[model samples]
Target: MILHTFTLTLGSTRPIYGSAHELRGFFATKFTEYTELHQHNADKFIYRYPVVQYKMIENVPTVIGINEGAEVLKQIFNDYQEIRLGENTYQIVERGISLKDEEFGISDKIHSYVFMTPWLALNQENYRKFYTLKGKPERDEFMRKILTGNILSMAKSLNYDVPGQIKCDTNVRFQKDRLKDVSVMVFSGKFHTNFLIPDLLGIGKSVSRGFGAVQQLKANNEGGSTCSSSSTQGAPT
Candidate 1:
């Protein structure tokens, strides 16, 4: 399958202090007619996987648009000159936008990916189950399953048919994070999977707010991989 993606990066005179959530709010408020930007329809939240995701890549505010969302982004690529986050106002000095058609779906070889932002892999119920696991091995196994399911959900959202069972292996470190002012468990680190996920695309929960954003790591001859320096370096604590 082919995934159509559009990425917009904004550069400001000063460092941008806003999180993805704030970035999203700025655009959603500006373009109230576009539901993809906010994933909300009136009072209820849209349950489908988000096609438009907001994030902070390398400390700069970035937005990723997929498929239909890409079309929406193209329509408003130059609509904003400034963004306000909390009490901080940033004047946009440089804007970069790129559109691409990327390969998506299962591949024969495994690819390595690192979470650019924290991966919200567990909910309240699963959070309790994860802690009750007997050992590290069990916990890792459980996480692997969760990661696989995440991929499957993304595929289903895009209407891509999975020809085979999805396989995943994770090497992550768990940590506590605050989402919407509520403390929650999140994961950081990398995973190996046969699925070909596009860069800057988000998985797991609250992806529209930038959690679970991942980028593929390019493999080197030393059997290690190097992540793109332009991508995220984890969300601020």
Candidate 2:
């Protein structure tokens, strides 16, 4: 996997919100009009996993991982050298793409993980699952189930065996009309080789729009093996 990062100096630093939506629109308009991942041919439609993922951090549009899908936008943006983000036009200060190592920064030993971007654990259907929990204990128990299920789903997506035991901190955050969690997963089994690289692959839902983004945290001997967790519910967006 390759990660392409675009650094832009916005005309004003007014703290842009809903940046993911803006970034998504910018690429969709510049690259292709179709909302679904497909290319229209004379008589057939070809489909494949869209390898492009992007999010704005500190006003920079960072392309999480690059592939056939990302190359088109990369070329045009780098060449054209300017972008219109909302009412402000951003001048590209610098751009670079780096190859991602597959190791996921873990050795044979146990390690901890963290969410660099908020991990959306629930979509519209499951939002009530967490909401109905009455107290901390109930909420925490529900969180474990969601996190474990999320981990298993992610593993299955990559064709890896489900870990016998998964431990994580119950850190939940709400943003952008999404229920997100930033927790650590400690796999009891051998860590998958592909995870060694800190690829910002979204885990739960709406990953194509940059939700559920997770990354490996630096290992430490201080924390307990059990997953530490937290959750916060924001006002309705």
Candidate 3:
């Protein structure tokens, strides 16, 4: 999996919410061509994988660009400096870029995994219906099925073909603060993990704006069999 993360450290400290929207707006101003591609894809109702995704981490607007997007971002932002977010203008004080692959401790084999971001698994119709329906138990069960299916669909779209029935367990919590009800899910089970490709690739709806971004929280150890993951106790980002 070839993935590159570009962390644009900002000079401002003011609280900036709805960063995904701001990031998209910035791309529209500077990278109009790519921005148009994003809009076009969204309108087409296609599964065309988004190469670039943006999120705010530690007051820094980080762009996790994969494959072609990585090259584009490096070319544009490498020489260009500074980007604005919302009402507050931020100076690009520092820029950090790094790549992650097999050497980065990501296992090729399948194993239990957790999400670094919430996993959104519904479309426009299903999403609205899900919220309108009553009963937490039924909602939770439906969420698990949809999420697992979405993962499989994502893998297929990425050319990671897995045969037969794939089993997975999901533990998720609904985050109401987002644009809608997004589920923060931890997925565990056995399957090929190599096809997941890009680190922090968004899975479901609004992926271009960073809705379903995920990171592997576990990796197979040197033993090639045992998986290792640290216990992170904190609120979901």
Candidate 1 per-residue lDDT, tens place, 53-168, comes to: 99987788999999999999999979888999878999999999898999999887778899999999886777888999999888887787777777877877889988875656
lDDT score for residue 120 of model 2: 60
For residue 8, give model 3's deviation from the true position in Å: 6.3
In candidate 3, list every pair of residues with a backbone clash: none
lDDT (C-alpha, whole model) for all candidates: 0.84, 0.47, 0.52
Q: How good is model 3 by TM-score?
A: 0.67
Provide backbone clash counts, one per model. 0, 17, 0
lDDT, candidate 2, 1-237, per-residue tens: 223332222233344444665666666667564433223444464432234566665555665543444445445545545566677666555665654334422134544455555666664445666677698777656655565555555444444453344444454544444223434222111111212334565555555565555655565333222432222221111
After TM-score superposition, what is the CA distance of residue 80 in candidate 2 from its true location, in Å?
2.9
Model number with the top TM-score:
1
The candidate with the higher lDDT, 1 or 2, is 1
Tens digits of per-residue lDDT for model 3 on 12-125? 344444477587668756766664324444346334556667766544566766556666676676545556777666655566676654222234455444454555556565
Question: How does residue 67 of candidate 3 score in lDDT?
Answer: 54
- Candidates by lDDT, descending order: 1, 3, 2
